[model samples]
Target: MVIKGLKHDAVAYNTMIGGFCRIGEVGKAEEFFREMGLSGVESSCVTFEHLISGYCQIGDVDSALLLYKDMCRKGLRPEGLTVDVVIRGLCGEKRVSEALEFLGVAMRNHEIAPKRKSYEFLIKGLCQEGRTEEALKLQAEMVGKGFEPNSEIYSAFIDANTKQGNDELAGMLKKEMAETQMPKKQE
Candidate 1:
């Protein structure tokens, strides 16, 4: 297209980047992204999103983080999906603490309103690491923000509490789950 002198806009650039990323050609995608910027095409959130997702998919979380920082430096406010991608990638890498910290900064700056899934992922990760107290605290914060934890998250908390000999807390969570009609934990 560039050879034909076709005018490429942000959407066209984003499409090319997304295509390359989909095929796991993140380097090419990044190349085109840079070209898009140099061509005076204004990069939108979608542009950054495609590249960020590509980096994350390739397990280059540091690159993804750097890209996120670049996006912020460009005054581009990240959307929920962007934040979710980074958070999920961090969690997948077992960097749950960093994910939580990033989320805190983003929320405090009013940059993004995290979806319930993000919290759930963090909660699950924390529970898996036996950080039950922190997980419970995060769940409480999620509830205070009007987001209901799902059955799996409740199950994790219950299991973690039970394993730690906090049977009373586990029972209380089970009762709350029942009241909310959440499915019972599988034996």
Candidate 2:
């Protein structure tokens, strides 16, 4: 599109960025964003979301967060989707503490409360890392925020505890699941 000079606009650049993200080509997406910058195309929140989501999908959370900070520094308000990607990346990397800290920032500074999946991912990651206490605390926080804990998250906690020889915590989680109507499988 840039080579052909068909029409350069934020929307067009965002569309291209979205396509690159879908294909897990975040590096290319970054290049496209730079091209958009050089071409005098002003970006929007959605533009940053697309690139951030792509980088997160590819396990490039550092890059995604860097882009996120850049968006903030440039005075572009981040949308919920951008926060979601950050949570996904942090949780996927087993960085639950960082994810939780960022979640707090999102809620306090940006008025973007995390979605249920965000909590789920954090809890799941903590559980996988054998941080049962942190996982339980996060689960409590999720429920306090009116978000229901999903079955998969509970199962991850249970399974992780079981694998770590923390039979007490595993049994406790199992009983909790039975009481809360969480699934027995799906771990």
Candidate 3:
């Protein structure tokens, strides 16, 4: 393609980066991402999205967070998948506070709406960390946005509230779970 007078543009670079990321070759993806910049091709949000996803895939949530910050610094508003990946990654690492902070910031400044799965991860992570109050608040927000809480979330709430001796809330959660006809997660 180079010999055919076609320089590697943003699209080509992004494709290569995305390919590497999908295959879990995040290091190579990063190399190409940097080289893409050195080659005078402005990286798009998709470029960052690919690399960030790669880092997340490899359990390098910190690295992904750095790239996400960089993307924000460059005035790029990440798409929904990118937001989901970052939130899921942070929650995977038990960094629920940071995930909540990121979500809060995005919603406050950019109105970024995460997918239901992202909310589920964040809510479950918070519950696991014994931050059930915050999790419940976040769950309310998610529900307010039209996301139906799944069985896992209801189970999480029931388990956490029961463990914490919040019997009223736990009983209410169980009743709600029954009303929804969602099966409870077996202990």
Tell me the whole-model lDDT of each prediction, alpha carbons only. Answer: 0.89, 0.85, 0.89
lDDT of 2 at 2: 47
Error of 3 at 74 (Å): 1.4
- Lowest summed lDDT across 10 adjacent residues in model 3 is found at 176-185
Candidate 2, residue 81: CA error in Å? 2.4
Model 2 segments more than 4 A misplaced: 1-6, 163-169, 175-179, 182-187
- The alpha-carbon lDDT assigned to residue 96 of candidate 1 equals 96
lDDT of 3 by residue, 45-153 (tens): 9999998999999999989989988999999988888888889989888888989888888777778887898889998998888998788888999999999898889
Ranked by lDDT from best down, the candidates are 3, 1, 2
lDDT, residue 10, model 1: 88
lDDT of 1 by residue, 68-102 (tens): 88888988888888788889899999999999999
Highest TM-score model number = 3
**Candidate 1 regions off by >4 Å?**
162-179, 182-187
User: Which one wins by TM-score: 2 or 3?
Assistant: 3
What TM-score goes with each of the models?
A: 0.85, 0.85, 0.88
User: What CA root-mean-square deviation does each model show from the true structure?
Assistant: 3.9, 4.0, 4.2
Ten-residue region with minimum lDDT total, candidate 1: 106-115
Point out where model 3 deviates above 4 Å: 3-5, 165-172, 182-187
